[model samples]
Target: MEIGNLNDYFKFFVALVAVVNPVGAIPVFINLTANQGIKARNATASIAALSVGIILMVVLFTGEAILRFFGISVGSFRVGGGILILLMAIAMLNAKMSNIRQTKEEELDSTERDSVAVVPLATPLLAGPGAISAVILHAQRHDSTLHYLYLSLAVVALTAITGLLLFLAPLISQWLGKTGINIVTRLMGLVMAAMGVEFIAHGLKQLFPILGAS
Candidate 1:
């Protein structure tokens, strides 16, 4: 690729990173592996990254079929994703605890011990519905196979880098401090909510001719 094309891909990668908000996930990772040793924490991070990467690749490659299997149009998916993003924003804005927080209760309630990697860390935390939807939408926006490949690779690379960063959760948390983390989370929440609304509005305009005409 030419320098210009590479720059474009870089921009796309950056946007995906922002949407994924891996840094925002650091706190969640810390909480999830609070009891684990360093080796366990590292293993959990590796598993989480691999799991998330696989999910995104699957969504990118087969999202259309997956949606069709459920009889869902892209427009419908966008609307649903918008609602989810909005809810996440509301939780962030209100400083409400996430479902990952509830995992602690589940741990206390259950005798079947599970690896933290598979539960709150990997599922709803890393490859959550919002992230999956974003990946699908990103894939849909690409027209060329080359572009898709570039974007897909970029997404994976960015995700992996983010996961690696999160592996240093203790250092990051200390660097950000409590108040700084809260501020960053709220800012990201606002941005995510806006992005969600924009996706919904764009989908509505595309799917509904009357709305577009108006």
Candidate 2:
């Protein structure tokens, strides 16, 4: 494999990590599952992680098709998605969850829901719009089955790490504390903002070839 391919893989993974911000979700996870027993909590974590994996995998494979069906070009999507991610990054920088991921109503609804695993935790929290857009953009990078398989593995590995963190949410929360979590979240936000800018720049180049000529 070319070194550039390896680098792309690494970049893709880092972008996903930043967009997902699994560690940042710990506080929300803890609060959502607070009333549950250890076994229940673990189950919730597993389901959430699995849901994330499945959701991303589906998006990785079919996202392009969906975009095409809507007559949307990748360049246009990158600009739009980049803006969404940039907004989320701004929120992250402030150590706050973006309403784009989950709205105030959703957060309130999550508390009363019977199963928070698939709804708020897995959908918007762990695999929200930013995460989905990141996956779709990466999917557009290569159109090979092997490449898709490799990306799939990366998704699986990421979700596994996320699951482990969620399963150990209490310990992580205690260790990091609120201040530490906020610190980490802010760092992630910085990374995410860079990624968003990169996406928008690349997209603009694609959309307006004149930009690339310069």
Candidate 3:
């Protein structure tokens, strides 16, 4: 509603984008769909995008309740999630996929599948723990109904953009080339690293108000 709120939401959106880093996943999408025709690749992209959005939205809404069941404190979860995100950020900085999301074996296995829309693409790549945790942390921190609605919209917007990128994977690949993609990935990596540090700092502040005040 206000400019500050809009800016906050924009940061939230950026955190989602950075953690998911769809641009970084483009090469993987291309490799996975290399065997398919253009139509099939587009189909896979659509499904993966929709699935990822739905999964993350569910987590965003229900994450706190799930944590309660598991007896995990928000601050504790924030610290852990920050670590996970930081690890992925480091991996991205190196221009490689994070092993936390997928292993080399999993990537190899995707090649043997008929469709990878839900496998490595949607789960490990898009809606992996890092992304899910980030959304959950954001949701938990901002629990207003208005924020919840905005979060859902943000997820949809992100997924749509990611799908568009995947749909144009070929053209994007040709345009960006390997070096360009790596450059973009590294930039996003820097953003992710900053977000990760912020998450950890917030969590620590919550746990230690004295340090936060200082």
Report the C-alpha displacement of residue 55, candidate 2, in angstroms. Answer: 0.1
- The C-alpha stretches of model 2 lying farther than 4 A from their native spots are 1-4
Instruction: Report the number of the highest-TM-score candidate.
Output: 2
Deviating ranges (above 4 Å) for candidate 1: 1-15, 97-112
Q: Model 3, stretches more than 4 Å misplaced?
A: 1-4
Per-residue lDDT tens digits of candidate 2, residues 142-161? 78777887788889989999
Top-scoring candidate (lDDT): 2
Task: Tell me the TM-score of model 1.
Answer: 0.83
Local accuracy of candidate 3 as per-residue lDDT tens digits, 108-172: 89899998999889998889999999899888866677888888889999999989998988899
Q: Against the true structure, what is each candidate's TM-score?
A: 0.83, 0.97, 0.96
Output the better candidate (1/3) by lDDT: 3
lDDT per residue as tens, model 1, 123-166: 56666777777777666665677867887788689667867877
Error of 1 at 31 (Å): 2.6
Model 2, residue pairs in steric clash: none
